[model samples]
Target: MSGTFVGMPAFPEAARGAVHNATLRANLRHATTTIRRKRAVAVAELSDWAELREAGKQIKDHTLRHLDRYLEQLEDAVTAAGGTVHWAADADEANRIVTGLVKATGETEVVKVKSMATQEIGLNEALEAAGIRAYETDLAELIVQLGDDRPSHILVPAIHRNRGEIRDIFRAEMTRWGRPAPDDLTDTPAELAEAARLHLREKFLRTKVGISGANFMVAETGTLVVVESEGNGRMCLTLPETLISVVGIEKTVPTWRDLEVFLQTLPRSSTAERMNPYTSMWTGTTDGDGPRAFHLVLLDNGRTDTLADAVGRQALRCIRCSACLNVCPVYERAGGHAYGSVYPGPIGAILSPQLRGTDSDIDASLPYASTLCGACYEVCPVAIDIPEVLVHLRERVAQGGQVTRAGTKVVLKPARGHAAERAAMRATRWALTHPGAVRAGQRLAARTRRFHPSRLPGPGKAWTATRDLPAVPPESFGDWWKRTNGGTRDERGGSR
Candidate 1:
């Protein structure tokens, strides 16, 4: 949830821990593969899924293009409909706004619907600083909270933890928060669920305020939508007197018709169902029906900065279904925690660097996490071309070691102790740009192919020490091709 990715290791360093954990790998494989297959089946059922996907993409793009206009419309509508709209420019601003909102409501505790926006802003940590207790109502989120763990997957936050591990977290940590874990708490799905249910039910009914993040907010109707599999969303949306929704600016769609596209694609892509069990929506506030007072905090938090980028702005189109995560080979082996952001896996690889910038070793490392296999692109409901973006970002990172912000580029210096890579890359780029020097060097290497060393020397010697250099042929490929097949002779022969 931290804005800065300082102290987080690069992907290779973080992934090493995940790859070594056999249980994590097994859990990732089983869960992702199952979800991938189910999602494929659900998607195949809809004949117009592609159009829906495109519409969703276009809707997000259009809204983003005229974001200032749509956002003002949203603010006007919400205010007219008896809701207050607060704008947050960054994580710190968002957190301060949320903390102030809670303090204004005179509530020390808030029951929360599963909200990724809050996670990105670290609202809970911020609230804790102000002595306001925030409770997660969604079941997986409850598991994450009670377990004192960070969310791994977006849809299923506790996907990394098996039942056994969950049982341990609940047994170990739940009591200190509010209700005690049942003495008979077991790893059995139903029992674990029951333990969480009892624990959350109390917080729901007792809390005076609720906090949430919406999947989509409709500008025309001043509506906020929350889609989920559990009944927790219903509790958070209805049970409290004052409901405060903290949502990202990018989550806005122009109208209800636009909302419907994601309603179809999101449920199928994320949970592998025809529809989520709960799709709770509200327009401002309804007296006696739900929360009597409502507030919508529209958070920018680096989004506007990201949207200014031509190639990077496409990341804003994500609906966070995380289908790409399931199909990602790197995510399967390395797991989600390695990404070090609330959003993880394929979406995280592109989205995180944009939202957080590639300043840190972790964000810089994320662009290189993929094999660029394009499996993520195949599964993405919005067709986010994640591999394309990853490579674009990798170029952004490796070339100047920096990311651009608002038409300006910022170069990043190598972290302490990684200077050798920067130097190596600089030399490589220099060698590549000068063709005459490269050709002469190549010819000499070919002439002395047998005498050429198998390993690099100097600062690079350590890199090739363990791995053998590729064998160079006696003749360069260009020379061999010229000697063996004259271009004109081959054309005359008409081999094709």
Candidate 2:
């Protein structure tokens, strides 16, 4: 959806380079493995984890079903509390609203909390285009910004980078952004964190405007919540005179009671902790307490279109915990950049295509990025059936793109690969429907089994490249059944 990631190739082509980068694979493997292991242990500590997970799912589903009523209720609550609310229908609108608001403040710079919504809408780039500088305050986000790179992971954006690389980024680029790294900065975790802390401190204190996205927005009181391990979000939320939050409309919960479910499940699923180190929540504004002015921009950005599909709508239930990414086999190897969106891994595989439409090469290929191992589903805190959604999206892609824009079906010509697959399925359907043809085909395959190649020829080669073709049997099951059962048939004309 953001032009920042424009011109990305399809998953197959994009992933090819990532797979060859040994260092990137190592970094992803180590980080994800550590996180997933700790998450498993943390989850095991809870006796009612399954119940909590289900409760969170139910809350999101119920809220989504009655989204319009709750959004209006939230807007009224926010307005009543002295905060202004703005509705953004798409990325451009959201960016424009935020940029205009920032420009109105008469400030040349703003500080940002780690926000996927902002990244999705390309808010930083928009601000830069308007000659406003936006500083990233989160530890990981700081590294990404200083290195002049795009975020790969959702929770930990720079998961593709190791300690040494981060140390290098800090030493080389921190001077240009704000403070410079120590002359002898080491790659140890503590040292890197301290370096980032020092680098972001000046931005936090001086920046008049703060921008953020929320983990959950309470509709009952119009409160927005941001939970994080580091204290940067707290600094950004509290210190700035003017604050603006760009949140997905789907992040809203009907009441504080519904918010309880996510408060428990999200931290454990994401950071593998019983609770985050800091959770910053605010409602409207108060004199001498936090920001003087609060602006809540509710972003739709194709979420309404995504909600139209019953099978695909479950993706809206995600809290962006990123638990699925940690456990995904495809994500472990190919890394997040291959997905080509601010959102990545298993969730991105389904979410990006729906949000952006399958018109682009990157969005079109995301559904095929997963191996359907179901690890992501098992680890999901809100019980999103990622595999089911992947299959549904694959069907949409195969049938010439089923996403709609402005009440019209937006169809792209099927990929050349899919066309071949459609032909194969058609041939398969015809043969399966005709018993005579099936019998003849099976006999033919048995006779030719010895001459069969281990690797396929033409388009089929891609499938067989990393996998073995199963050996054709010496005889068909029908012939064997007939021979073993004395050519007997039951009343139903089945083998006895």
Candidate 3:
């Protein structure tokens, strides 16, 4: 729900442009294909992957079921460990709390680890508006920041950009932020990484405040974990004098023992590695070790509303592995930008609508963005039934049902442009209930089959534009059955 994505075009309209970009398609295809193959191999090496996935799902379900208790326990543990806890009920509150925390430190600039929660709240924009400059230290995040672009992927935010484009961004925009790129920076991976490293190092050493979002928070110990392939997370978590983390309340697990399940599944599912190269875990603050001041902002931002739905609550179990993105046929082609949220791909389709309510054009269109392939569910570490949620959300959008917005229950008007669909569904239900009417309708359709237009007019044109209307046969199936048999068959034996 960041302002960055506000007023975005609906998915179909946005995807129409993305689908035409050959270079973007090439970049996404190569990245997703490579990751997909490697993930398969990495997952196959584990003998009890199904067990691990189920265990992960059960743990999240149990923790979410008792979320209030775990959150209180986590807050107490954090306070006891010398860290302060702040509860944020929505995006505006979270941003205000983080901005206020940074202002309290008297620092004008803060270094950031890659954080989806921060992105969700649009923290950088909020900080910038308050005269605080926030620098993104993650390699991919750096690319996005330098280009003044929004992230298109979750794990690898700059997945849409190739090497050459990255080099261009650094060369053109790096100096305005901090360190400038090398004059002769090449398009090689090593060179690009080195350019980002040198550029971020100065900011890392000088910045007095650091901000992050955690992969998981241990309620029993008040420890937060961030897993990454690069060591930038370590630097951000340790180097700054003041550290503030904005985490969704749903990211908390009951104990360190429950954290074990995700530590195994996340690395393999995300980067296709047995273990990530860097995993940083910190509890409160340590003397003469890391940041002397620690603040944790717990963000609720519609998560409580999402948890209120039994069928939709499973989305809270996601570990941000992004396995579902790689396997999603829709994501592969439409790309992440089309989803119009910090979260993209299959997860975004279901998650965004719930978090933001399907009242907006972009949020309303997201549930219809997928093809319902179920590939996302097959690869999900916590087995979130994404297709099931998509359909459920579709019903919510079509029928206009009771939903929670900002913690209050409200009924939404059915989304615009669905009147015909709603009427058709009602007609279908009626015909199915009345066999005689269905028989009559079928015979009428068969008789007037040739008179049917090849293309429809008005509202129906949109549906028929890309699809062919199936031609009706000369006779209905029921009529053919009766003619062949000459009479109804007796239930106990043969035709009479």
Candidate 4:
């Protein structure tokens, strides 16, 4: 529930506990089912939905290909607009930069807009360690913060909690963070919203430093955009005296024209809305308008390494829409916590391993998390081939380790476990490639079919425990075909 993902087990192990919890399963089933149904209706409204989806994908791909040029352009534009840009190579560097910025402001508390980039770097935990209090203003995020829980979904962090649970959390935990919930508060939507609003209002007015993550950063205008259904993002962006936005480098697009494609796709894909209720945009700072000081920390955080992979680089195209999560059978039952990262579901399966590497149990296990149903790929706004990437990462996991390309040099890091799986795959590859060996092996197996065991031995025993091992035929297909002369005759070469 804490910001840190340390010590979490692999997906299968973590999911085991979640799958058994009846309350958790009920919560996930209801939430994901509702969201996916509504998203379908919203998407159906657009006649050119397919075109828009393709446009968004093309825009993201183009930007990623020329990310350096656009990023440099963005820096020049932001600096020209009275904003300072800082580049962070990883999470530690990003946290240090953000912490230093807050410390320099001489403030101990900061209000936060729901920013995945900040969460990814564990900025809240990092700031807490530095004695700085970071408050989450988004209602769902507020629920997560007050409940001391990690986000299960990208858009709706509190999706795992029902209304009754939320009411209880508000009553029990609200006072510790700020204003107490009304003693007679009911388990109604309005009351819960009001309670969160009142509690967060105090922090919004008092806090001078605000931290955020943008949905999109326009390279041409040096503008950062945050789109949300609630008005909390607007409050965090404007009310605070100094605003520090920690954004991923891949969030950049070449121009506002390019931004337009996502503007249409992101809202519908994420919140199922035609347009977000509040679309906040800021070009650095306006002396009389918004924050006095604006700092942009562009975070790499293994993104550059992920970019080194041709298939894996598509993850950077993510706009943080939870569309894939809603449609994913694996995520619905297992929940986001099973993935053990800020990003969860289908995207997490491929993205986490690449960003964090497959050395850990969780990362290695993430690739095998899905059924490879391709529901995720179908819903993705950017059309990222999530299933394709999942297969690619699985290959990496089973083939020893990651193959990272740094310019002309390729670096390989040995990963733990998967030895048996690797051996099996290698043997399979060899057997499949050698026609004579395959034919001979099939003939030998067919000859000894009567003596074959009903179950496999060793590690494969568990696989065949619940399911029957297929019965081998008395004769191999080749021999049958040859004997029948391609099935034209029974025992003679002549046609019957």
- Please, what are the lDDT tens digits per residue for candidate 3 over residues 21-50? 999999999999999999999999999999
- Local distance difference test, each candidate: 0.85, 0.91, 0.92, 0.89
TM-scores of all predicted structures: 0.91, 0.95, 0.96, 0.94
lDDT winner:
3
Question: Deviation in angstroms for 261 in model 2?
Answer: 1.3
Tens-digit lDDT track for model 4 on 1-496?
Answer: 2555888898989999999988989999998888888899999999999999898888889999999999999999999999999999888999999999999999999999999999889999999999999999999899999899899888988888999999999999998987999999999999999888888888888899999999999999999999987788999899889999999999999898887788888989998888889999999899899899999999988788888888899998999898999999999999989999988999988888888877788988999999999999999999999999999887777664446632333555445466666678789999999989998999888889889999999988877998999998888888889888889886656778
lDDT agreement of model 1 with the native = 0.85
Write down the TM-score for model 4: 0.94
Q: Candidate 3: RMSD over Cα atoms?
A: 2.9
Better of 1 and 4 by lDDT: 4
Error of 2 at 405 (Å): 2.5
lDDT of 2 by residue, 216-327 (tens): 9889998889998899999999999999999999999999888778889999999999999999888899888989999999999989888887899999999999999999
Backbone clashes per model, in order?
A: 0, 0, 0, 0
TM-score of 3: 0.96
Highest TM-score model number: 3
Ten consecutive residues with minimal summed lDDT in candidate 2? Answer: 401-410
Model 3 error, position 168 (Å) = 0.7
